[model samples]
Target: MSSIYIHIPFCKQACHYCDFHFSTSMGKKDAMIQALIRELELRKDEFRDEVVDCIYFGGGTPSVLETEEITLLIQTVYTHYQVTTDPEITLEANPDDLSEAKIEALHASPINRLSIGVQSFFEEDLKLMNRAHNATEALQCIMLSRKRFQNISIDLIYGIPEMSTARWIQNIEQALALDVPHISAYALTVEPKTALEKFIKKGIIPPVEDEVAQAHHAILVERLEAEGYHNYEFSNFGKPGAFSQNNTAYWEGKSYIGIGPGAHSYDGKRRAWNVSNNPRYIKAISQDMLPQDVEELTLTDQYNEYVMTRLRTQKGVSLSEVQTLFGDKMHRYLLQQAQSHIEAHFLFQEADRLYVTKKGKFLSDGIAADLFMLNLFQHPFDQNSNQS
Candidate 1:
């Protein structure tokens, strides 16, 4: 199924570890929204042959906008595309923005899912991450959101510098106790030029230990699985029937249109992305231009993309499907690349499917890269746009 992703690039505050495409100031908010609407109009034909099944309002922080602004954006999508009757519309929000009035407004609005960025449930961790919301608001918003929104997902981070295993367990237990349907947990990595990286460089923050993160991941997988949450994706856990349709469709390589500054879109053969600079993006869109770079994927490029995305999921890579879509040469190349990992017990092929073992889940990215045909093509985009 096809989808639409609108990136709202304004945030209340920048988290210490985040290097996403977002502006801390909202001075260009109005212009950006108009640009987003115009982008949707311009890219309408990309999905004309397919009806939209999901619309994701991801950000800087989508909840930073007023409810009316959110409605206007969704209305623009409906005006430009053939949306399903019950589209899975998700708004990426921060706890501080979801006041009682705001939640009530969203209940009346068309948004069906709320992906709150509640990175941690402890006050110290919140401060360490520079998250705008306090620990109380983290719990409070989820409690309040449950009253109106059932399809809710909370984003959490583990392996903070000195964060204890008990605290990590507390974070997971808190999320489970809230009965949130989906949980997207990630390890804390000190990205280059980010505050976390600088702090670590200056001995202000301790470096992230791989062992700590692995242990945390192990606890997360085991505990969440016992709690009936499926480890559907490497970083995501969801209850049965509560998986994210928008993300699942994306992971499976479906066509999607991405609007707003810094958003990326894929249309089967090629990928395109908007400019990261807010002012530049607004100026170009105002002149009726799509301020983005587009790349045409070669056969090898497509095969590598398939391997990276497919390997991260529970399904792994299907050898038969690979042969059908990518040809015998590519299929043989993949098998050749995977043999070493299978020998290491990091990967196993059962029947026609290749799956990552529990021992290899935390190292999935490196493992996927190990299987990549890097000599085929250059990496796409500036590496800064890694977050979804």
Candidate 2:
């Protein structure tokens, strides 16, 4: 099955820690929406014959779109793709944008899921993050949203230096108390060039200490588990049957089409990403061209992609599927390299499936890089090629 991702690159305000490609300007919203519909038609044949399982409206913030704009995009997808009867159409929204009227529009739309960007429930944390919404609205919208959308997933950012273990526990407790179907929690990382990094450099904000982040991460695991949330993916926790279908499809290497600036698309063997600049994207697509960079995956590239994504999830890497897709020699390499992690109690093997254990989850990125193919350095994803 295939999936679709639409990037709405407009927001009311920019969060300090966010490095995503989005603009604070709404002047281009009308043009962007119209261009998006045209681009969807342009890339209609990308997915070919696979049935579309999920359509994700991600952002700057999708909730910023008017109801008519949202409806028109949904119509565009249905017109061009082989969408399933009950596709999981999810919209990424901020608490401040979810008004009563917008909620009513969402309730009546084809969109069936809501993924709210409730980074924190505390006013202090929200202010530190420079979030547009205050703590009151964050809590208020969830209560209001539940009446309309059944499949709701909210994001929580943990390990902010200002967020204590007790405060983190309260955040988890509040989410559980709300009883949303799914939750995705992440440890904050300071990416280069973000305001958070500059603030730390200037001593305006304290840098995130690795040890402190690790401690908070431990608390997250313990508390979410206690609250009956399964750590499905490394950063995601959900009750049974509530895992995000869109992201799960990505982790499983399903082909998907991404429409909009900074969006990426993968069709098993090749991947492409649009130009990140809004004006450049609009100009290019206005000329009937999809402004994207493309790469065809080499065998080694494919293997590394699998290692990076699969190891982060609870399912681990499936040896049977590996052999089926990559042939015997690749399978042999995996079995050989896996013995070390298994002996170290980081990864466990069961009936040909290799999965990361609880202790191994934190160091997953390092482990996956270590297992990369030694040969075939020409591939864009070759870890060693990019590393010193």
Candidate 3:
């Protein structure tokens, strides 16, 4: 099934660790919303034959928008394209923006799922991340949201500088106590040019250690699994029937359309992304133009992506599918490359599928990279011969 991702590129404020494309200004909010609708209309033909099963509102913080604005966007999608009867429409939000009135308004809208960005439940962590919500607000928003929404997901951050194991455990416990159906937890990464990186470089904040993150992740898996939450993905934990349909579609390589600036779309063989600059996007869409770049994926590129995305999930990689899709040579290469990791107990094979061991979950990216083909050679069975 296909999905639609609508990017709301405005936020109340910037978080110290975020490098996502967004602005703190609301001057262009109305224009941006119009532009998004226009873009969706312009791209309706792309999904004319597909049924949209999920419509995800992701962004700097989708909750910042008025409830009517969100409903208008959803209606626009319905007006322009075919949608499933019971589509999973999700809105990514922040705790500070989800007041009692706001939650009630959102519940009345088409949004059936809430992915709240409650990065931490501690005062010190909140201040460090510059999260808009205080600890109390974070706790209270989830309580309020649970009253109206059943499909709720909360974000939690680990590996904060000076955050002890006890504190990290406390954060997870707080989330478990909230009893949300899904939890997307991530390590605090220091992206280049972000405030977090600058602070660490200047000794204002201590450096984030990989060791700390690894330890926290182990604890997270053990604790969550014991509580009946499946670590379906490396950074995602969900109770049964609570996994994100939008995200699951993405991971499974289903086609999707991305509306708005700094958004991306994939159609199995090609990928496209809108310009990150909001003004440029609005100007282009006003003229009935798509301000995006497109690229066709080569055979090697597709194989690498398959390994990367599938390996990150519990399903792992299917050896038979690899041979069928990428041919016997590539399949053999994968098995050869995976031999060392398999022997080291970082990965294991059961039947025809290969999965990362618990010891290698934190380093899954690196392990997937090791299996990537570098386009250094061309096989006779390769279909995209132009790249060769």
Candidate 1, superposed: residue stretches over 4 Å from native: 376-388
- Candidate 2: the clashing residue pairs are none
Of the candidates shown, which would achieve the greatest TM-score relative to the real structure?
3
**Per-residue lDDT of candidate 2, residues 1-388 (tens digit):** 6799999999999888898899999998888998899899999987667899999999899899987899899999999989999899999999999987788899999888999999899999999889999999999999999998889999999889678888988998899899997988888889889998999899999888777777777788888888788887888888888889998998888899999999999987899999998888988899999999999887787888988889888898999887776766677778888889999999999987898887778888888887888565432233332222
Q: Whose TM-score is higher: candidate 2's or candidate 3's?
A: 3
Please list all clashing residue pairs in model 3, or write none if there are none.
Answer: none
lDDT of 2 at 234: 84
The lDDT values for all models are 0.90, 0.88, 0.94
Candidate 1 lDDT tens digits, 173-199: 999899999999999998889998888
TM-score of each: 0.96, 0.95, 0.98
What does the lDDT read for residue 44 in candidate 2?
A: 92
Question: What would the TM-score be for candidate 3 when compared with the true structure?
Answer: 0.98
Model 3 agreement with the true structure over 10-90: per-residue lDDT tens digits: 999999999999999999999999999999999999999999999999998899999999999999999999999999999
